[model samples]
Target chain A: MMPGSLRAACVAVLRRDLLLAWRRRGDIALPVLYALIVTTLFPFALGPNDDLLARVAGGVVLVTVLLAMLLAFDALFRPDLEDGSLEQLMLAPQPLALLLGMKILAHWVSTALPLIVIAPILASMLHLPAHANAVLVLALLVATPLLSLLGSVLVALTAGTRRSGMLLALMLLPLCVPVVIFAAGAVSAAQEGLPWIAPIAWLGAALALMLILAPLACAAALRIAIDA
Target chain B: MTAENSPSALLAARDLTFLRQDEPVFGPLDFALRAGEVVLVEGDNGSGKTTLMRVVVGLLHADEGTLYLDGAPLDRDLARGRLLFLAHHLGLKADLSPLENLRIAIGLYGCREAITPQQALHTVGLQGYEHEPVRQLSAGQKKRSALARLLLVPADIWLLDEPFANLDREGIALVNRLIERHVAEGGAAMVTSHGAVTFLHGEPRRLRLSA
Candidate 1:
């Protein structure tokens, strides 16, 4: 196949996924709603102490977003696997890793983009300091794609199994630890008026590394799942 | 069409074997498919007909075998643009309309020339139902929607598993016509069915698998 055609294939997969997500916009809203509800419940469960809520707000938002993102992960490859589009993907002339990268990008656009946009509302709802909001969103911007990218590999591994939600979470949660730590740590530092760019930069670095490796791993895992 | 008599294989398998749970599914089998020819694979349940197609499409790796495409060792990425595999699942996204599904399928496989999704849908007898979501289509229509890929995409080899399964008489005839035109144009196909159906064109070779 021509190089131009390969690039066209990637764009086609990306557009197709985005169009599908747009058609099912209700499903896309669930994760954002979950983030909002969970973030709102924090202050109620811990009493109305602003200091206490604000102190833990960074960690709370990170954990909530992570959990919300996990909800979408179960769906990343399930629809394709069930309908056999995954088999077509494997057989495409384009490199599987390149094709999977487009899919991960689409997943982030559909699921994680909304969470990042609304995260500050949730953060402020939890009484998180106003100054830390930008850093929180920035951290989320970097970390959420990391979550989608890393989570996709696990999702691909479990795509063929029935009831793979719990298995996907089990496989993915451990891998998300560093991203959560760095993102939450950045927000907490910003809350304390410290220079927070270092941790956020570290998160970016990790994301860059994941960008290079996650798609390849996910593609390999998809092949295994299909062959099983 | 002259390549049909050229004595060269378009697709060839040497000592192909696949195992599930360490037991052989089908193995040590050798076959060659030439241009403008059809090979019908027959087998009983669990006899590995589907597995063989899966292996041929590179969805599953043969445990021990060599596969060649057009006289060269098979490199899936290089050979992919030349092949299309239609399995039992149909590969349609239920939420998407037939037009959208065909567009995506054609785009992914990289069409040889500009062919509108509408034209492909029309050819597949889905003209009136182009915008209906696949879930709303009857089983035969869904299969036809998937079959639109054969008309829209440029591929020389087609691997179909139970292509006649869910189709009514007319739908079955549609598949046979597609196969006939494809082989007549020098494309090759391998189809698996429980029993044989009359081909409208070239003589179809048969390969039977034993459990």
Candidate 2:
């Protein structure tokens, strides 16, 4: 038997996922729309005061993006799990962790990247100061992938469970706390004119750590989840 | 049941037992699948055939006993790319065209020499439907799209669970032809079916599991 090429397998996994996301482009739009709607609702509910909106804008956008990502995260592995594509991926000659990492990368691209692309607009909508808005974007840039990496493991762990959406959120809350803290801390520090690089650095460190570990964890979790 | 334990068998298992919640799904089972052979895992619904396939594919671990690949302890790393498994779930992305799906399979499994994805699709009787999304194809057509992988990927062992489930008479014949060609080319296949349809000629080996 010819040994499968890791490069070819990685490209295949990435292309398959991206193509699937394109075919059902509505799904990619869902989280973006959700983020938009949630960001739009804040000023209305919190009253039209610029000071109030600016003060709360960074935190609100961070939480909204977090919740929006959570909304889209359940799908990271569910479709593949149901369709047995994931099984094929597992049996492929390449390391399952590497394939899963590609999947997480694709998921981040389809779901979180869109949200991040619109973050500046979202932040501006809530009257976030321009400097703090840049920090918010920077924070999300490092943070969303961190959330995606963390969320993927939880999603894989709950994969075999029925209606795992709520269970996913509950299980992820504790893990997401640190991510949220660091991200929001960065934005708020920028707002207060304090150096925000420390919190951004923390999130980057965590993202770098999860960048190596989450896929490995997710692969093991999926293997265990599908054991029945 | 017979356990030939051929020294040159490409794949063999000894006393393989799997437990579901600590209750044995199959116990102390033994079999050897040599190259250029076809083994039919015949059993009723819930007879652990699919579970056995999944176990051999390394998705599920056996509670007890060992699996050997080429007379050595089955190392999953080494066994991959050598075993091809086609389960009830065809694994074709419903949204992708069959050609694209086949390309992904070839990309992951590595292509058999000289066989293009288009040629494989045409060989599987999916020529005109090559660009049709798998979701729109009939159930039988979806199965054929998956069967095309057998032609495009270079796996020495094929584990096909319920290969006949969604096929018409012609599709069944196509499967037999594929298996015969695979075995003729020195590859082996283990097919599981519970129905009473006629199988490949030459009295292929049967491994039965009682529910």
Candidate 3:
């Protein structure tokens, strides 16, 4: 029987994911550092002129951060899936959607949430304007979780595909385009002192939609993935 | 959930069919488990034994057929608690200690009468080694840790796929004892294996799967 208490199952899955991240701290850190390094290359490649870097920094940071999240995403369910913990999760009486939601939330905490927290320091390195800096981080705080949620669905969908990392990026980058555009556009509008409410609202809408549907997709994908 | 008042089969599969990449795995398959009965599923290599087990557990939906648990359609939620399945892959976390692994397993199964962590350790024959990481354990020891899961909790039906895969003689004896105890208690089980199981008390109903 599925647990009478859905909330308890959700909490349980969330705790399990967090524990996984904690135990495999090295694997988790490598991706985070990879993101940091990839983001750091922007100024060096474009020359150190602060104004020139600032002009394109918003898009660069958002795209790079989104890429970083995608890079780490294949790791999200792959290890568990390979090791068969995924089957246990699937067979748990709790709704797979709810359990997947807990996992996505944990992914956000460990991946996107940390990215948002670290955005400020990276933003400074990119010479983002003061107002745009806050906007960039705020937009990322809102946006990256959406990326994580969507990435999770694709990761689950393509769970055991050969070269799944590449496939995941192929499948998710297109889906993530809107999030990348709206997030970077929000910062861009703020940089020009224009009302960026439309893009922010769009980003929020994307997040809300993904929050609702991604887990279900992930559950269905898990069924197929497990077979593979 | 289905009404407990109904005298429904604990597990049933009707006309189940499954294919992998266009190759027929199992077709027109039918099986059931009643209270106090054990079903021994036997087959040769590549004969869909594991696939049949997966389909029964709802891990893989049959390409064509219906399944029911306790008179209810094998709803994923209901099956979760009603079925205790051990796949070919032991599913033990390599990094976690055995005790930690058992705790996660208990939590996932949501067993109301779950044994204490210590009892689980003792039942698995790992009383002093519960704290040792799974990566350090021998294959048979890890298999024992998984079998211990059966002792710590109860389920409506048990599905074991190659449960004796890597066990030593003693480990095999212990597993047979566990199965005997479970059957003696009136629980149902469906196990698949390539070799004959000699210790079963009664002639278990047999189902053969072929590629």
**TM-score (all chains, Cα) for each model:** 0.95, 0.98, 0.92
Tens digits of per-residue lDDT for model 2, A50-127: 999999999999899999999998788888888888899989999999999999999999999999999899889889
| Model 3 ranges off by over 4 Å | A1-5, B1-8, B21-23, B71-73, B112-114, B196-202
Best by lDDT: 2
Candidate 3: residue pairs that collide:
none
Question: What is the total number of backbone clashes in candidate 1?
Answer: 0
What is each candidate's fraction of native interface contacts (fnat)?
Answer: 0.67, 0.68, 0.49
Q: DockQ score for model 1, please?
A: 0.61
What is the Å distance of residue B43 in model 3 from its true position? Answer: 1.0
Query: Residue B199 in candidate 2 has what lDDT?
Result: 60
Rank candidates, TM-score, best first. 2, 1, 3
Clashing pairs for predicted structure model 1, backbone only? none
In angstroms, how far off is A193's CA in candidate 1?
0.9
For model 2, the TM-score of its B chain against the native B chain is 0.96
Comparing 2 with 3 on DockQ, the higher-scoring candidate is 2
Q: Of the pair 1 and 2, which is ahead by DockQ?
A: 2
Each candidate's lDDT (Cα)?
A: 0.86, 0.90, 0.78
- Report the TM-score measured on chain A for model 3: 0.93
B5-39 in candidate 3: lDDT tens per residue?
24546787777888778777887877777787788
lDDT, candidate 2, residue B141? 93
DockQ of all candidate complexes: 0.61, 0.68, 0.49
User: Model 1, range A1-228, lDDT digits (tens) per residue?
Assistant: 342277778878998999999999999999999999898888889999989999998899889989998888887888888788888888887888999999999999999999988988888887888889989999999999888889988888888789777777788778988888899899999999999999999989989999989999999888888785
